[model samples]
Target: MMLAILIICSQITIPLPGVPLTLQTFAIGMIATMLPLRDCLLIIFTYLLIGSVGLPVFANFAGGLPILLSPLGGYLIGFLIYGLITSGILGLTSRSSLTICLANFLGAASQLIIGGLWLIPANHLTLSQAMTIGVIPFIIPGILKLFLVVIVAQRLLKARLLAR
Candidate 1:
């Protein structure tokens, strides 16, 4: 069910220059908060594997190895990294809103860093140019997503709709 939600979220794309804006990070945040660390990693890895095998599970319904080889590929891999970090944080910390918010922020930062680094070599861009396109535009939206994730996860936990 969570994997399906992620796939749907991944399809909700606003195409940008190289990386398309999607609800993936938001869904990832929620998944990391709600599921156990091993389960969260499994879901993320499964999503990546499905997309890598050409199942149209990526942004704009893109799939296959080519999608994984594209400039935006690192962001896809970043999802796994983000899930790992967020899940680890959730495991170690209390499930307060602040904790979730911090975890999501850190996860977003990791994604931005990895994606920016990959963009530099893949797109033949300078660090400034990569940051300009890959990281800058996403920061605000990422924060907004973090806020939403924190609120929603808190509510879900309070309502007993989601596991801690």
Candidate 2:
């Protein structure tokens, strides 16, 4: 549900070679920390399925197998890893603000890895070149996203705790 909503709100465009500022990453991290690992993966996969079927589920209102086959496809696949890593890390932590932040950062790193892998072959880039084109440009934004998602997750968890 959240992924669908985010997809509609967001659009896909590779400002760089492999990195797009879609809400997919943000949504993945948020869902990972909030939902169970299985559910998070389901949501990630569902989003892709929607996109693959030409639902415009990608960023910039782009979708279809063409997008998936594109360099950004790696990042799309990375969303699954992002969700799994974030959810798993949060599951092991004490549900504290600090740990949630750590989880988000780790999730972001995982997404970067996926993005880099996608860029290398798709863009004909080396590791260092891929990092420059696929990873470096997005670092600041990704960090900001991690901080924001952590803050929101912490607040939500805190509120739930208070409610209990």
Q: Which is the leading candidate under lDDT?
A: 1
The residue pairs that clash in candidate 1, if any, are none
Model 1 misses residue 100 by how many Å? 0.5
lDDT of 1 by residue, 26-126 (tens): 99989988888999999999998989998998888889988888898888889888988888999999999889888888987998789887898899999
* Each prediction's whole-model lDDT (CA): 0.89, 0.79
**Model 2 over residues 1-164: C-alpha lDDT tens digits?**
77765575456444543456665667777888888888888888888998999997788778799888888888888888888888888777777778888888888898888887788889888999988888888888888878888888888888888999
Query: Model 2 off-target regions past 4 Å?
Result: 12-18
TM-score for predicted model 2 compared with the true structure: 0.90
TM-score of candidate 1 on Cα atoms, chains taken together: 0.95
